[model samples]
Target: MAYGQGLADRVRTLAPDRVTTATDLFGTETAETALALGVPPERISTIAAGPNPPGGVRGTGGEQARPADLERITDAILAGEITVPIAATFPIEQIREAVTLQAGRHVHGKIVVTL
Candidate 1:
């Protein structure tokens, strides 16, 4: 709750009721931290495993995670119920425009610039 001199960085989880926002995995070298935070590996059982690489959840924004939240999203994505739409693709020269569009919330999903 307080950001002082020596506090470890923390993130806000989508489900604060049952999620952790730290970058450490429950079973990795960060085990002690996870234990201190009360997030165990067993709580990560049903995650709708992805072909994507691990540590993919780390974000530019500090967002927290609960396994259930991940499963819910993965299920919807896999089921074609919810999709990440590529709203627009532009050329390299158009990168600035694309960013402006995104900043203004005019673009949805991912905005990409190609060669």
Candidate 2:
């Protein structure tokens, strides 16, 4: 879940030895930094979308998905195989507050705003 080089460097500096794997959903620069920090190529994985691709390495995290993949996921949701959590609900009038709450990032799941 690291988004910046600083965070990645911090992870490298403070990561526990027991942690054998890390996922970089940020970009390739962070992934390279992870490698420089002594994490093996296989242990440090990244997603294929976002600012950069995985630099030819297959992304271990499921951040990159095609339209078909999204469709399949939607189908699964419709089929009751997947569930979406709603952290909070608000009326359209409270949209501003809802946005503020989401920016706080303390909620456990999606925030729904009723129209």
- The top-ranked prediction according to lDDT is 2
- Candidate 1 local lDDT, 1-115, one digit each (tens): 2233322335224234645433332223333333345665443222222332133332222145666887888898899976567878989999898888888854446788899
Which segments of model 2 are wrong by more than 4 Å?
Answer: 1-50, 53-71
Candidate 1 colliding pairs: 12-64, 13-64
Mind giving the per-residue lDDT tens digits that candidate 2 earns over 28-85?
7666665656667777667644544454334754556676888897998899976677
Candidate 1 TM-score versus the reference = 0.30
The best candidate by TM-score is 2
| Stretches of candidate 1 exceeding 4 Å from the true structure | 1-82
Consecutive 10-residue window with the lowest summed lDDT within model 1: 53-62
TM-scores for all predictions? 0.30, 0.43
